[model samples]
Target chain A: MSRALLEVHGISVVFGGLRAVDDVSFEIHDREILGLLGPNGAGKTTCFNAISGVYPPTLGDILLDGARTNGAPPHGMARLGVGRTFQIVRPFSGLSVRENVIVALGGPRYRGNLLRSLTSWRKKGIADEAGAILDRVGLLDVADRTSGQLPIGSLRRVEIARALALSPRLLLLDESFSGLRSTEIAQIEELIRSIREDGVSVLLIEHNMKVAMGLSDRVVVLDHGRKLAEGKPSEVASNQAVIEAYLGRGERGNVA
Target chain B: MDYFATVATLIVIQAIAACGLNVIVGYAGQISLGHAAFFGIGAYASAMLTTKAGLTFWQALPAALLITMLLGFLLGLPSLRVREDFLAITTIGINFIVEAVFIYTPFFGGALGIGGIPRVVVMGGRLGNNQFLALCLVFLVLSLALCRQFARAWAGLACFAVREDETAASSMGISPVRAKLSAFVLGTGMAGLAGTLYAHYARFISAGDFGFPVSISIMSMVVLGGMGTLFGPLLGAMIIGILPEIFRPLIDYRMFIYSVLLLLMIRFQPGGLLGDSSLVVGLLKSLKKLVKPKNIANPREIGGDGDV
Candidate 1:
């Protein structure tokens, strides 16, 4: 196989004495969807944070498209086409919905000449660009509304939309379907699938098994910060160790 | 007429200075109570350069801006480590330090301050009040235009993003430090520019002119006029800078009234007069209703009130 779009190799994150993410390894290829599944305290979010550069891994390397990106800051991750959503959605509350997306779009454009960036008044195109992203996320109707006024469902979509505005080659979605209704989750599933169809790789951290099993091309299970299993969704879901780890080696309780 | 013109000139100068404070306080969401220190730096720099070094007004203006901006950058470096309440206290300390340096140091004429700041002359003729007011207005318009341009620029958006949330801004590839420092350099430089204009226009200066109270007043302009709005600071400068003079008979109660107005503004309308609050929209809607002919109503709007 060709090179993976994102590679996590022997990554371990230590918070004081406790290893938050212990020797986790994974590889996500181009246009692929990899579901990261674990119960609470499984270190899924920790792994995501390490990968997205909120905090660096204590050991091992993160490779984005064959380039070593270990220890890069969040802004550096963004510049390298790695976009992510917060698990606990952080929208720019003071800004309008469209302005949120526009601010995200400003990420790469910040590299422009200082004087040119200041004096150039050709902001004529940025609104249209933000509008287009909002349209894709079905937020175009409420584009003028303040982001803080939106319901949780719409705010989740706005978070995704803002991440997409980065024009990322790889998108890291942290609990995108959490706190969403069934219908909202279904819509987000479709959106995630469509994002993958658009040639953007997805690394999804999900507690919901149905969406994870149905949507991810591959699944990696984490148990106490260790990689419990990794394979095709069906294979990993049926693995005896995975089943035991999830259901405590008792009756075959429903995963969902 | 001369008195009115002088007040107008002072308002214009304060408006320019207020715009600088607005960028740090409003757009970048940073606290700066020592803004008048930058203004003092500019005024002192221009005054000394003109009187001691014999540089012309134009030459001294740029030098003053550069010197003040450098100081602003240096001062901004330490503030970056702290935020909000701590930052405010740090700026207050800076204001006191600048005041003491001017008062105790004889290089800047001690407490008396440098005098005889040469008048801005064109074609070898001293400018009259009208001409000088016209000059200040030109600079005011240029400064306002610069601010408007910065607000719409990518850099400005980054500042806004940083102001909203630093982590989120960084995730979107904006360096919060760079955005904040840029705000300080630009905003403080503008304050310095305003100082240069004030020195030349007033034809005299003293350390007492730019002190802690002046910094508070400048901040009050940004807060009262509406932080974050383009024209809010200018509107604030007019209200706080000139309105008090209008009620000069109640000079003892000026600060008290300002305190009441600001308190009411913060309590009822945190966004300021023209801030991003819906109060302005509601007020405008009411004004529009008051102005329009009540008989001529749109058919589609009969049952549909546009209130959100």
Candidate 2:
């Protein structure tokens, strides 16, 4: 219905002789949520890495806002409005929660020019902005606490908050729901919905079937590094190939 | 009095240089074993500018800073590509190469070093030892202020982020290259400032003064004082700089003592004396517990014998 915020066109990523992700294509429109589903070692994370510029694709192109950005460095991609989080949380453990967000806020300022960065007053303004973002992410109470001391669920929120600090047009969340409690998952799902409501498109890699099906506007499944299926939840659920991929060939006939 | 002033001036100079090294090693989490090379470069550049180019000491100061910082930027560009131990080895190699250049290059005085460098001239008069000490103190304060500002700045935060995780830092849009290069450029620039002051104050220069040993000594000052803390380098410089003079009788065992002290620090207190989790604070807490027993019923039981 809207212009695509991100388009991954026939992208393949190969590490040495192994094709980690082979010729996968997808599109996420403005304010849309796209769930990329796969079994373990299905190259889902590799695809995310290629799109987020961690590893440039061995073939094909990635377009953000219709601009070719397949080979930019990770930070270059971030500055161009592609934000991301790791599957394993990476928090600046020594720094406070607020400071972690502040670091991200300062990133788009052209490597923070020496003169401007030296000004102490600007830090106050940036801290205020960090506080507001922390408030939005519900991390305000523990803003001064070191991030390393935070629990896993809070750390996941910190990862999300840090990515949100980039003010990205496209947010690539790699397994944000894993290792979270059921309540935490519900909260994160609501947070993701709000983030999309605020006009940021989301591309999430999820292992949880029900949540992925419930949350994503569209879903694409990968099996053995190849696109297995793509459609709405109900349509994709009844697809013979996806059933066989998930439940095995003999059990597919029993699914009605 | 003059001897005390000289030792104080030397301490101040070393402290300034240590502060610079801390910015790179402490804040940015980059190990540089070639910091003394930059210091020597600053000293040499200032000395040559004043003696050969006929520039005033004041003029040579900024020129030396620029020269040293430029060299730091160039060196940082290639070294930043490597991580951790490889980067450390690269810096160690740089120290050796730079020392060799100073020794063999006739333009750098070929081991003898540049001499007859002009001193600070104030109000048409050469500054006395005390006055020179005062000047160095002023510079030390300036260096400390610069370091404090850097610690509070966004660039410093970026350095911390880069230190924590380069991939995450890049994902957040902070360039690891920029964070590290700035640390190098600023750190080496401060080293240059210290060198310029040292050259003018000492009234002579020698290639042996800025060799690998000096680099190790500066690094020790940062580590011993508490890497990343503002006052840590100053404290470290005081101890390391004054120890030799205080223990002149045992000068032969100087390196031995230093090695022992460093070993103890690393093993017992890796955070250094002033770092967040320092031994000093741990000792203080234990001392407090000893003095005002936390459990009255078991005052003599240090381990809270009956609580469990």
The DockQ leader among the candidates is: 1
Chain A of candidate 1 compared with the true chain A, TM-score: 0.94
lDDT of 2 at A105: 86
Candidate 1: Cα lDDT at A60: 93
Flag regions of model 2 displaced more than 4 Å: A109-112, A121-123, A250-256, B284-308
Supply candidate 1's per-residue lDDT for B51.
Answer: 95
lDDT, model 2, position A46: 96
Q: lDDT per residue, candidate 2, A1-256, as tens digits?
A: 6999899999999998899989999899999999999788889999999988889999999999999999999999989988898899999999999989988888655354668877663436778888899998889999999999999999999999999999999999999999999999999999999999999999999999999999999999998889999988788877888887787755455643
Superposed Cα deviation of residue B232, candidate 1 (Å): 1.2
**For model 1, which pairs clash?**
none
Candidate 2 per-residue lDDT over residues B1-308, each given as its tens digit: 99999999999999999999999999999989989999999999999999999998888999999999999899889998899999999998888888899899999889788889998998889899999999999999999999998888888888889888889988898889988998889999999999999999888998888998999999999999899999999999999989999899999999999999999998877878999788787889999999987665655565666676
* DockQ (0 to 1) for model 1: 0.62
Candidate 2 all-Cα RMSD: 4.8
